[model samples]
Target: MLVRKARLPDADSIHALIRSLSFDGTLLPRTFAEICENVRDFTVVENDRGEFAGCGALHLYGPHLAEIRSIAVTPRARKQGAGSAIVQALLAEADTHSVSCVCLFTRLPDFFRQLGFAQVDRTALPDKIYKDCANCPRIHACDEIAMARGVLPDIAVLGPAQVEERLIPLQL
Candidate 1:
């Protein structure tokens, strides 16, 4: 499969893929407009025949932090390295921008562990907490484990953890 940066035309398919898993919280549901707005943040994988295989995104919170979001491969694409390739592309995207750390909330810790991420206290990602977590219905009882590929250079960059700006409204 060829892994490359995602474009505008790819948004609908990517949204469909993520939405398929969002109902169970395997991924957070995103709207078509939201996907278009963040399309620059994503990288997608396509099979040899050029069909959508999987996608992942690198969302920057600041110079100190970036989060990997919506990484899901189609059922037929799993175990074929499409997911890994998309993740590696997302990591490269972070590195290219000089992000000091890359963090993600996932139940699939082993999958991320194999990609060089280490388990981190959820509090270590204050920006994520300030942004996404505040809107999450499970804030008081989150099941997802937080993981990071690098130490956050400065937590201050994340701002206040307990306060929510509600800057971006998300759909569960």
Candidate 2:
């Protein structure tokens, strides 16, 4: 399989993969518009025949915090290393940008553990909860685990104390 930065033409396929998982409530739903707007954040994996295999996105929240979102592999492509390749590519992109840390909310903690992400309390990332989880239907009964990797240069950038102090209630 080949992995590369996503292009506009890849949006439809990426959206389909994400939509399939989201339909089962395994991931957050992303609209075609949303995918297009953040298209640059994604990396796509394509099979040798040029079929889309999987996709993931790195969303920068601030100088020190970025979140990995919308990771999904085609069901037929699962266990074939497509998921790992997509994540590795996203993390590598994060490293290239010198992002201090990468965070994600997922049900697959084991998968992330293999990628060096450690389980973190959701409370530890109030900013993320406030920004995304608040609007999520599962917020009150979330089954997803929060995980992170790398060192965040400035904890204050997303510290709960700081987030509360500068809190602005609005839909993000």
Candidate 3:
């Protein structure tokens, strides 16, 4: 499979992959406009003949962290290294930006564990919680496990205090 940075023309294929996966609650649904706007964050994989195999994205939270979002591969593409290639490419992209660590919330932690990710407490990723979890429909009922690769940064911006301020208090 050939893994490469996504361009504008790749948006539809990427959107379809994410949308198909989102139905299972394995991924969050993304709007077409949002995909177009963040297309730069994505990397797509295709077969030698250029058939779309899979796609993944690295969402920059800051210099300290980037989140791996929306990684999905077609069933037909399984076992072909498309998913792994997409992730490896995204990790390389993180390294290029000097990001100290990459984090992701996934049900497939074992898959990521083999890729150097370790399970971590949600509290350890406050910036991620502040950005996505704070508004997520599953916030109070999330099932996905959090994982991170690389050492935690020395910077303190995304820690508890910073996140608490941004959280909207909820009442049942």
Which pairs in model 2 have colliding backbones?
none
- Clash pairs, candidate 1, are none
lDDT tens digits, residue span 75-161, model 3: 889887888989999999999999998999999999999999999997888788777787687899999999999876545355556
Question: Higher TM-score: candidate 2 or 3?
Answer: 3
Instruction: For each of the candidates, give the backbone clash count.
Output: 0, 0, 0
lDDT of 2 by residue, 18-37 (tens): 88887778888889999999
**Stretches of model 3 off by over 4 angstroms after superposition:** 154-172
TM-scores, each model vs. reference = 0.91, 0.87, 0.89
lDDT of candidate 2 at residue 81, scale 0 to 100: 94
List lDDT for all candidates, in order: 0.88, 0.85, 0.88
Model 2 per-residue lDDT at 153 = 34
lDDT of 1 at 32: 92
- For model 1, residues 43-98, the per-residue Cα lDDT tens digits are 99999999998899999988788999999999998998889889998898898889
lDDT of 1: 0.88
Off by over 4 Å in 1: 158-172
